[model samples]
Target chain A: MARPSDTKTRIQAVARELFMEQGVQNTSLKQISDRLGITKPALYYHFESREALVRSILQPLLDDLDTFTATLAPGDARRLLEDCFELMWRHREVLVMLLHDPGTMLGLDLVERVWEWRKRLTALLLGPSPSAAARIHATVAIGGMSDCVVEHASLPFEEVRAAAVAAALAALQS
Target chain B: MARPSDTKTRIQAVARELFMEQGVQNTSLKQISDRLGITKPALYYHFESREALVRSILQPLLDDLDTFTATLAPGDARRLLEDCFELMWRHREVLVMLLHDPGTMLGLDLVERVWEWRKRLTALLLGPSPSAAARIHATVAIGGMSDCVVEHASLPFEEVRAAAVAAALAALQS
Candidate 1:
């Protein structure tokens, strides 16, 4: 048997693949267990419910975003924005899932959390007392980065990353 | 009794309003007819089905986009982009409906048409045989304008229009 920690990681990987392929609504715990070659009881030993499994899969990405946001300082916005584009590119599948099916796959509460995190991130990027134009600029910048990552997922990573960062910076500075 | 043309226009306006307020799936034909103070037969006379109504609402936007794209010249990319943003802003309610409930509300054919329109728009912006980076830049520029229009629909139109156009131009130039 895989070690407990290794088993948890494996479960998350399998679940993410299944969710992306067939959608979170169509995927079930049984399918995940069957793919993992584990029994239902074994799957239940780790995750109490499908929602719990989803939370487990998503928590790490959220934590990474939180850590990145927590490290923001003055004058670091441009570099940090680039880093953010890279991070989002690394996790593009999850981002696509969240964007494509927020209501059915993730539910309203989690969607609200993602929106709140984005609002905070935007505020941090723009700094204190930003004008309305500045706020709109930041919002558009982030939106541009997200669309680039999701829409051009098949492109070479380095090229897409560089282009998205450039576009985002231009939106911010304009 | 209202004129046939007047009734059709009234149904479209009321349906758009209700769809934005309570989502497309939640709003039924009966509710729409009730709000318009029309009988079911009158509503059915104007629109054979809800899908037909949705198509009617979207076809004009697509026609407008088609007309705009047909008029583009070599040096008109920037001006055309600004005009595209204005068009998107004017029809943002429909855009929001398509974004929020894409699968159930708009159906696959309509969504495919929207996607096709966007691809055509991107091609026009980037020109033929563009580099991957240029394509990404164009995608991001359009995405920025879309996000600005959809997310800040409550903001004054001129402010959002000016900010989105400026940001889109910067994204393209960068």
Candidate 2:
């Protein structure tokens, strides 16, 4: 039998897996509970709604971005940008979720968080006196790196990762 | 009085504007008709449903990608890619519409056309025997360009276009 903490983690994991496979709208608490061999009541003990479940699922991802961003020194621009790309590549599922489900209120809130992260990233990438074009370039480059892995769905995972990193680094240089 | 064709064109233009401004889900055919100073029946003469109106708006954009892709010669790989970016930049609003409200059946159909265009483009960018990693890089670089322009609401139009073009060209080269 799973411990209380273990059960809570399992629900999140199952919820995320279902969300990814079937989309956020289609996945219900009952479905998640069914998949986990837990009662629907058991699932609700951890999350009252799918929105709460999504937020819980994404909290760690947001925290990771925060932690990574906070660790960068002011002038460590290149590494900071690279780290951002690395984090995005590593957390491709979170991004896929963002792209596929940007319409929901939850999705919009997540997008706002993403936007804030991008602004901080842009400041870090272009230390001072970024022209309108340079700033746009930095933002697009970072944005591209975050979402590129999903489109390369046919390629082997490692190949996709390597290519994404290289292209992201190149975008940084330009 | 506008000619019949001119009236049709005006409705489309206004609908596209409203879609961009208010989003597809929020905009209604009645609103579109009223904004164009036409009766509901008149709007229906040109478009039977909101879905039809959206398709009419998107068809030209899809046709543009078709026309653009058809012009690419084997030796003009780089030019072809740049032209594609320019087309996307030029039709930024339509691209944003597709990105934001990727609706039900018809929306997916239009998106599939764009995907096909991208596949054709992927073929052109990478000559025979390009590595899997190269293909992924190409997808990131190219896909990122358009995706960035649409998502980065803060970036100015020309800067986004220029950065997308430059980043794509650099990725193609490297």
Find the candidate with the highest lDDT and give its number. 1
Clashing pairs in 1: none
Tell me the tens digit of each residue's lDDT in model 1 across A39-151: 87887888897788888777767777667656655456777678778878887898776664454434535555566667667777887688889988887788899999888
Model 1 deviation from the true structure expressed as Cα RMSD, one decimal place: 4.7
RMSD per model, one decimal: 4.7, 4.5
Query: What is candidate 2's TM-score for chain B alone?
Result: 0.76
Question: lDDT values of the candidates?
Answer: 0.77, 0.69
- Cα lDDT of model 2 overall? 0.69
**Model 2 lDDT, residue B110, Cα:** 65
For B9-77, candidate 2 gives per-residue lDDT tens digits of: 899899888877655665788898899887888987777876777777877777787787677566565
For model 2, residues A25-127, the per-residue Cα lDDT tens digits are 5467889999999888886777786677878877767888777756756656556756776787667786666555455434435556666777777777776
Q: Distance (Å) between predicted and true CA of B9, model 2?
A: 6.4
TM-scores of all candidate predictions against the true structure: 0.76, 0.77
**Model 1 stretches with alpha carbons more than 4 Å out:** A3-50, A53-56, A104-108, B3-50, B53-57, B69-73, B104-108
